[model samples]
Target: MSIFPVYQDVVSIANLSKEQLPFFMRHVTVYKRKRLHHHDFAELALIVEGNGTELINGKPHELRPGTITFLLPHHIHELHTTESGPPLQVYNCLFDISLAVGPQSDPELSNLFMNSVEEFPAYTDLSGEAFEKMKRIYLELFHEYSGSSPGRNALIRAKLTEAIVLYIRSRPSFPVPGEKSLQPHPKDHFWEMIQYVHNHYMDDLDSTLLSEQFGVSASWIHRSFKKYLGQGFLQYIHTLRLRRASGLLIATDMGIHDVAVEVGFESYRTFSRIFKEMTGITPSEYRASYAKTMK
Candidate 1:
């Protein structure tokens, strides 16, 4: 199996509903430091204007016009912007597909989602006339969604998915160097460390260990993590462990203690405290809510 996840241009709210999905939309102008937060929803960020760095899973992806970021559930990430000329315009959508309701829930659809290659789930660049068309599609989808009408929600979902598909197909599959790839960024080394950390989050994690593993000094590891992922090593590791814990809480029949230990926590008490801090709910509560679905 590939390590990367695949993205199918979701084109209909019906498709999302058929797949047991939930969705939300918003716009934000971001500037400053934000702590890492975890969510069960799949997220999409559409860059309508401005530029910045999007730190995802411990790597930095350049964010600018036409940049679309699809973040999987429990993917720890943050955003930092230095551009002062224009406020970064973005449309953020969060979704869930656990109860998806349409053709998109097909086996083929499920298979395709596992094939995502680039850290940025998908990318496309639009300028001049093409940019206008892209803007129109987004505006129309938002308008239809917000307006009072029967099945407007369904209509919005369908149009939004279509807009995403068309946007993905109309642009290049690979990002240009220095724009959104690991190849040319000064923070590429940080990406390597992130991949390493992700592969080993279940093990004991610390800066000294990661530093030695990466053949760098502990300070370098700490700084790089903050610079690239916007969080310290310990914070990032906790995020990873908490995310895994959530999966277990929702997907397993194991007791809370077992789930805690399985995800590398030392004790159930510690696990409970951290889980509550990150998710605003106890492990038992989360489990109670999603356990039936797991069954």
Candidate 2:
């Protein structure tokens, strides 16, 4: 997942009567894809119908119907569909790690379910019979979450427990890695540069320096930026600097010229010109407007 999960806050996937209900289910359909992100909760996603590549930590894995994947709290992933590819329909069941906190008095069932989750695959492509079973279990869980019957929340946990057992029985070889390794891996040099630019955006960073630091050809670096991030390095860095400068303006009383220098602009005039071009207001005016809104 090139995009980290810091952008989106905790996702409200589960609906529970009490605040402590440990399970939640939501349907996710991807038509116009958004940025890749990671979050603080583990999620189980079943692809009911779709064809695409699920990019997990910069590596691409093929996804089709009956595909089930378990994502750790820190897994960075995004679905990349072809230009004319079919839209994806997936059941995303997100729950906290605390869901596995206490055993439900049936230690055997708890062990089975928790073991299944701990050993779950990053991507599992189910075969004919197994695929049908997975799909059915996912549907059952979705229905349980959608209905308002008494004890629906408790029923969701039970259905999910059954689903995990069914999934394991489909392939008893628990804890074994699937075709794709579950180990977290580093991104390639291009993304390394992208990340470096993000971390050091306030510095006087550019393509030549980044290429030298990452030891890749400058043209390849430029191409990689455009290919992966859909923008040149300069434009991306400018956007980052603008965002930081705006934050500082709102959060601090720094002068406009100091803010420009602080954000690595050569002069306030250049900063103001570009800021206006991008945001359509002078820095001071933007801060003033923000202050008024706060008041």
Candidate 3:
């Protein structure tokens, strides 16, 4: 028996040879969007202006401005716009990872890839200043791509490099608290509170304030931190403080008491005790050892 032929438009830029160009970008406008589809290439979609539901691996998320996603090969997904809602518009940038195979083989560049590619979340919300920075990059990329300027390839690579570097260095919205058995549903809220604490770790951080701000149960907040962060909330704060103190010890000539206060320790006595407990050495001893090593 003979089988009938089937057809699908592979996710590739038309008129482009894979051997020549590995990067492509386009502005997309859709009144009615396509169904879930898989692609062999990776994609980065920046929501320009649209309201819709994005289904990724069967989970749905409300997509709006400042929403960005990095799609991996074979990740099944699609978008659906509301009838009375806004139009579905986006800038979709596609690239072949094979283009960077040689660079990625080096340890330093591989580390860059790890942070920019492997460590990124599936989707991120970029708002306020972060969103503006992304918009600028997108605009520059578009302008350079559309113009037939000299050293075009080099400039395009520079734009992409800037974007990737920004992505890697941007502060993460969530916590990657090591590998452990997740406590269950509702426990994932650890990251939301974690971000807030990271921004205010130098201030007073307590379960009560976190619960009040996040609207979750105080016990749940504490439990989430304990399970996901592998430590209780207070312990996490102390860890951050000690980390800052260590940096100050090495990078500054600040006195021990000043370093303690700089890192938010209430008093030098409490700071010294915690520092010794965490590092197994007094703050002054750590500073002395570091100074000697630098010589």
Candidate 4:
């Protein structure tokens, strides 16, 4: 069995109700370093006190009071407390990606969840008025999440949205490489298409299928993907599938064929060819290399 951990939403978050939005918050103190792990839900953590190091996707960043780290689904990360410093304390909030990029969400807000190949940094340092504002929102979010008041869910959503907007505002904006600055498109449903693919990548997806589903021509879908995402539809789907397959190879004991099938490939040969082509290693080799790292 693989040693790495992959946290699932159903297992990690508690008190989730079908009738209510999926959100959880807690005040946590880290005395020792956590194991390197990834989860299938989005996380926003505010450093409340102490000092630590956050290693995310193989990059290390210092964590101190007023620092906020945003982790998307499947981002491998861990937290380490300094030996001489006090424990790292933070307000950790977890929620479904849908909460951040739902159908009703604004385009700018929805872009925040598209971290597969991000144009912005994953974590940002907030200070002065920004820190104070975020702290207040987090406090209110905790209260609403723990309380049974009417419209609590709506309030929680509003606060979360506010927090996200504030975080975005705090960051320095940059144009996407090879593309002009993004603008809001009232009729553009690209984000909705992206979200749909993210949720259903394990299913058979193609331009024709997506075109039919979205009531647009296949060529339009292809052009939108190329213009916005810098990749074709098939490429995007393969990237998502490969990412999931890689995680499974490291975090589960599923067979190679099963892993491929789990991520939507029908033929083992095709899966192996594509896996090696993209990752430059066979599935078994990838798993074995990760095992070596653990040892």
Q: State which candidate has the highest lDDT.
A: 4
What is each predicted model's overall lDDT from 0 to 1? Answer: 0.62, 0.67, 0.66, 0.76
lDDT of 3 at 281: 96
Q: Kindly report which residue pairs in candidate 4 clash with one another.
A: none
RMSD of each: 8.8, 10.6, 17.8, 13.0
> What TM-score, to 2 decimals, does candidate 4 have?
0.59
Q: Which ranges in model 3 have alpha carbons more than 4 Å from their true place? A: 1-12, 99-109, 115-120, 171-295
TM-score of each: 0.54, 0.54, 0.51, 0.59
Model 1 worst lDDT run, 10 consecutive residues = 1-10
True-structure lDDT of candidate 2: 0.67
Off by over 4 Å in 2: 1-4, 11-20, 32-34, 101-121, 171-295
- Sort order, TM-score high to low: 4, 1, 2, 3
lDDT per residue as tens, model 4, 1-295: 2223344443224534334576778898899787666655688889989888887654567899998988776666678998888999899888766788878777777876564226676788899999999999999999999899999989999999998888777766663333221223445455556656765778888888888887889988887777766677787778778877876676567899998898899988988999999989999998898777666
lDDT of 2 by residue, 200-292 (tens): 677888888887797777887777667666667677667767766775676556788999998889888889998999898988888888777
Best by TM-score: 4
lDDT string, candidate 1, 173-264, tens digits = 55456434332336336555665676577787788888777678888787766765667777778877877676555544678899889778
